[model samples]
Target chain A: MAIVAKSLKYTKHGEPQDVLELVEQKIESPQAKQVLVKILAAPINPADINTIQGKYPVKPKFPAVAGNEFVGEVICVGDEVKSVETGQHVVPLATGLGTWTTHAVYQEDQVMAVSKNVGLAEAATITVNPCTAYRMLKDFVQLKPGDTVIQNGANSAVGQAVHQLCRAWGINSIGIVRNRPEIEELKQMLQCLGATAILTEEEIRTSDIFKTGKLKRPKLAFNCVGGKSATEVSRHLDNSGVMVTYGGMSREPVTVATGPLIFKDIAFRGFWMTRWSKENYDTPERKQMFKDLCDLMEQGKFVAPVHEMVPLDKFKDAAAAALSFKGFTGKKFILDMSK
Target chain B: MAIVAKSLKYTKHGEPQDVLELVEQKIESPQAKQVLVKILAAPINPADINTIQGKYPVKPKFPAVAGNEFVGEVICVGDEVKSVETGQHVVPLATGLGTWTTHAVYQEDQVMAVSKNVGLAEAATITVNPCTAYRMLKDFVQLKPGDTVIQNGANSAVGQAVHQLCRAWGINSIGIVRNRPEIEELKQMLQCLGATAILTEEEIRTSDIFKTGKLKRPKLAFNCVGGKSATEVSRHLDNSGVMVTYGGMSREPVTVATGPLIFKDIAFRGFWMTRWSKENYDTPERKQMFKDLCDLMEQGKFVAPVHEMVPLDKFKDAAAAALSFKGFTGKKFILDMSK
Candidate 1:
């Protein structure tokens, strides 16, 4: 039987509130090696917004469906599919799955059958932000017990995830954020997530972090907001430490003084989850990383917070709410397709 | 009986040609656990110039002798000394034993005996430059047969050492130098040292190396000249590769664009021989490194090209010869301390 479904599509690239449209389309039967999935819940992530606006490198083919991560239930299997059984919940491995639809079809290998104990909303937010945070910490620098890492944009989803993961690994973290009027409240929130210390960008700039002295310096620095924030983080690292940059939210270029590279021997590196996942698809290390993350989630060491659930017809409203500063205070907006 | 020795001493820090004085003094008896050595040969390296200017870190307490590396003969040993025999040729194991005088005293354990097979000139230059080249290649990056490494200052002592060692390991090297009137002669000289490709800084900037769709890029870049040369080398690296910076000849500073660090995930690092040797002293690894370097030298894989040999009294002529800008040439000015 044909499955008639509706999907949120973008005809042109722009702000999420302006370009997204909900339209009915015919979902064909699964081809060989494909599995048809009913997308049960999907979260609105910052990367998803960037993907829709065509700002990110991993852009979907135009007139594209624009969602990277979601939780779904397998409704039907193709002729050659045997890995995932019908009626099981799953999450797609990476971007380009376009999960903002009532139903979707993907190759059997591209989907992972999740444990029944994890809730749909939590699973929806797991594949991107948490994985990115975990990989960035573990891959770039070898962190020993009591070793410290510092990062800016400490109030974002990935920042909270990094804090919790570092805590689990017996490492310390210093979080940096912009100086807002609600900084005290923000500090409390980050501390609750296991941040060892929190500071404002202005404080880091005015301090003696750069003047060579015996101060406690971080061994690794995570940067999301570029411009002066990156330069400041570079200054606070010990000799031979690394700075791994993933995002540039301020849309400013990352500038570094040559003295640090020449005198102190610091390293600069980058990380992108979509690119890493795509490149390491068939490697055993990739498989082991996924298994490790799943184990962490099963042990209750990791958690994904959902801000609000919106229906498919209210997709535009959901996108706006996700992008709005007022509604998404430490919460991720999820789309529930059941309605 | 005391040894009557003539030594060069600097009463105060000043330019190499100005304040240095040659004086005759009576050498005291060797203390317990000390050995007296007669200096044979030493090269006036760039670091020596910096030392005489009092610009190097580890400055001598004033009125001090000024060379760091040399070949010498053990003439006498203190009553308590056991390991080193008198009349054997030895080299100081880098530090505290200034090598600029006719006769000096040191602890028996503070020296390494050189084989009769290796010439004194070769042993004089071995302690720093060749060891740096070896450590930088092996310690930081994993090299495989057919992998390419590019470096600036190809005519430098360290750079020439790298070219020969890379060739021995079946690794390829692309050497960069400043444009000179004797460009053809320079290219031929580097080629004889086993450089696979040679290019001037200007040719690289105006070439198609950075154009899109190029099939080959270097797996590692070694930067001795900072500023524009470093950036140009960085532009030609494959994704996730490393650029190791050890020297800054241009004095213009190493500037890297943020796009490579954020998107391509390249790494930038620095290496210092003084720090490495001091930190890893007496380890089996350090001993093995020296042995390997000696074996390479014995097999004729490494050679120090001396341009001029000067007597101790001709110190001004030696300094001028070392600092001359005669375009693409070998190391100049060796001190024949025996004279």
Candidate 2:
């Protein structure tokens, strides 16, 4: 039987609302080594919007479907499919799979089986931000249990993931965020998620934490927001420490003083999940990382950030909401394709 | 007979001329495992000035003698001293030994015998600048023959050493300097030392070397002049390349765009010769580095930078010249203590 799939696609690069349109395609039954998946849920990431505008490094081909990550269920499998079975939940094994469709056909190697024990929101958005957080922490400096880590964008999805992972590893974290009216509320929320301490960008420079030696200087700093915040975060790192940049929300360059670079032996590096996945797709280490994240989610030790769900037809609204900096700036918007 | 030594001493941090004084002290004969040496030559490095002004990361104790590196001739050795014979040349094995003197006593373990085949000037200025250049090239990047390196301040002492060493290693270098009145003369000098190309800072951004692919994007970049030069140099690095900072002549911070850090995966790190020597004092790697440099110098492949020799009594002039930018900016000044 043939499956009629509805997808959000763009024929040209422009604003999401102006260029994205709904299109129907006939997806045949699973080919020799293919599987048919019914996408259940997906999230609208900032990178997705950038991709639509052709501003991101990873550009899609013209007439391309939108969305990078999602959680789906296997409806049918070809005779050669041994890694996955019908009625199994899975996620894209790599990036640029275009997961915004109601139904799609994929080669068996393109999807990996995931445990259904994870919440829909957590499983749908798990492949990108959480994986990025995991790699940044694991691949950079080797932190001992008592070692301290500092990061900005404390309210970001990746930052929250870092907090939980650090907690699980018995490492201390000092999270930094911008000052807002609900700063107190955000601080309390982060503290509950296992942040050892939380401060705004302004407080970071004046705080006695670095002076009193009560908390050792951070050995690793995660920078998602650049500009002055990146500089402030990097200045507090211990000697020979490294600051890894995975995202740039401020659109500013990373600045470091000569004193730190030469005297303190500080280092700066970058991490990209898309590149990592593409380069290491066939490695056992990548599989192990996914297994570890799923295990934590199933144990309730890690939870997805605050999210609002919208049905597939309301994707334009979800995209607009994700792009807005108005009320609830920290929450993610997920499309419930099952609806 | 008691040996009377005249040494420059500083009791506090201030201008080198104001705080420095020639003090006379009695130096006794070599005791048990000790060797007495007559200081020969020491170069006036910018770091020495910084050290006197208490602006460097390494601070000396009060009432400290002035120089950090020198070449000296062994005059007398105790019964237990075996590392060097009388009339042999040696340099300090550790920093802060105060080399600006007529005579001083050192333990057998405190000095390393170097080849007299090297000239007095080359052997005297060998420990810091040459070692820094070597370490910056070897430690930060795994460069092979034909690979390209880019650096600013290509007329500085360290920069000259880099040009010679890259020549020895068969690596290509793009040397950047400021537009001086004698720019052509300076460029010819660097090219004779094996620099593949030399340009002013203003020409770096407009250069087509990176885009033409005739010269591959540099795998390693040496940044001595921070600020705009550092930014321009780093922007041209190959993917996953590193820029190692050793000095900041411009007294400005190193700034890099967020795009390169995340999208191109360029890295920035620092290299301090003092730190590396202290941390790896006992390693075979340190010994091997010295051997490599000495071998190159002995082969006439590496030569000390152009220098003007001033007797100890003319130290005031040398200090002033070393601190000036108008005349002999690229030349080093050495104190001929023996004369």
Candidate 3:
């Protein structure tokens, strides 16, 4: 039987509010080794917005659906499908899953069966930010228990994940954020999530820690907001340390002074979660990472804080609110497809 | 009895031609752990020039004795000295020994006694360049037998050491050099030293081998010239590869494009042997490195290419010639202090 479904589509690339169009489309029956999943929830991440605007590398083929992650229940399974049974909840293992629709048909290997205990809202945001934070900490350097890391954009989803993960591992972190009027409240929030020290960018830039005594330097630095924030983080890195730049929110290029690179033997590298996952990795290694993340989530050490939930029909208004940082205090706006 | 000695001293920092002076001064008896040695042979290296010009960190308080690596015979031992016996030949295990003098004093632990088979000139050049090359190859990365490394400044002392050591370990190297009139001769020389390929900088920059995919990209690129050459080498590195910048001869800063760093996950780091040895490591590691270097030298995989053996009186002329790139090829300019 043909499954008639409603999906959010955009015929042209532009701002999310201007281009989003909800339309009815015919969903085909599950092909061989495929499962038909009914979408439950998906978050509007910054990367998802970039993908919708055609700025990200893996943009959907035009006249396409727009979403990289979502949590759903398997309604039907192909004859060849055996691992994931019908009525099981699953999430895509990667980006470009086009999870904004009412239903998606993907190969069995593309989806991971999530635990029943994990809420759909939390599961929806799991594949990107948390995975990125986990991989960056684990892959870049061999860190011991007491080693420290410094990161900018500490109030963002990935930064909070890093803060919690590092805390669980007995590692320390210095979190950097822009100075806002609610700086005290932001600091308390990050501290509750296990940040060791939280500082404004201006405080770090003008700190006397570098001038007077033996400075405490981080072994690794995580940079998301590029531009001068990257430079400021680099100053607190120890000799032979590495700084990994993963995002350019300020849209300004990351720059490094030649003296530190030459004299102190600091390394500069970058990380992109989608690109890293797409490259071949050992199967056992990936499985272990997922298990660890799940364990952390079950223990309440890794929690996804949702600001608000909006029905599918309100996506345009929700997306606009997500993009605008004027009044939001936490991770913003999840789309509830069940409505 | 009054112990008196004649030593070469520089009262002020300047060009090697103007400041070096021979002065007679009374030598004090060795302290409890110090030993005096009669100088044998010391080589003038570019670093020695920098030291004499007060550019190096460990500068002597002037009327400063200025020489670095050298061979000597133990003339007197302090009461507690146990490492060396009178009439034994030894070389300093570090810089700042001031090997240009007729006699010098050092702590007993500061010298390494040499085997009878190693020549004084070979021992004189052993401590710095060869050790730098050896440590860089072994300590920084895990290189298997079939791995390949590309290096610029192929005719340099450190470069020559790297070529020979890599050959001994069954690793391949592509050597790059500036264009010279005797380019063929230089190529033949490096080939005899076991370089798999040698290319002029211009050839490497514009070669069809890189563009047409005829040659494999190197996993490691060793850069000495830090301008466009380093960036060009970075372009030819494999994904997740490293480019180590150890020198900047062109005086132009190393510039890296953001795309490769962001997309490919390439790493850029620097190596300064002196700073690394002095600040980061301890005495036992230094001894182990020296022992390994001596073993390589004994196996004939490491050779100190001496350009000329000039007497101490001709130091000015030799220094002038050593500073210029016009003539005299390969490693050291030996100063025979005994003359």
Q: What is the DockQ of each candidate?
A: 0.35, 0.86, 0.37
Put down candidate 3 lDDT per residue, A1-98, tens digits, no spaces: 78877888887888888998888889889988999999999888887887777777665888888888898999999999988988888988866777
Error of 3 at B339 (Å): 3.6
Can you write out model 1's per-residue Cα lDDT over A5-103, one digit (the tens) per residue? 788888888988888888789988998999999999888887788778777666577788878888999999999998898999889875688889999
The prediction achieving the highest DockQ against the true structure is 2
Clashing pairs in 3: none
Q: What is the lDDT of candidate 3?
A: 0.79
Which parts of model 2 have CA positions greater than 4 angstroms off?
A326-328, B326-328
| Predicted structure 1, TM vs. truth | 0.87
Clashing pairs counted in every model? 0, 0, 0
For model 2, what is the alpha-carbon lDDT of residue B286? 86
> Model 2: per-residue lDDT, tens digit, B97-144?
888888889888878889999888889989998898899889888999
Q: Model 2 clash pairs?
A: none
Best by TM-score: 2
Docking class of 3: acceptable
Please name the candidate that would achieve the greatest lDDT relative to the true structure: 2
Candidate 1 chain B weakest lDDT stretch, 10 residues: B323-332
Error of 3 at A335 (Å): 3.8
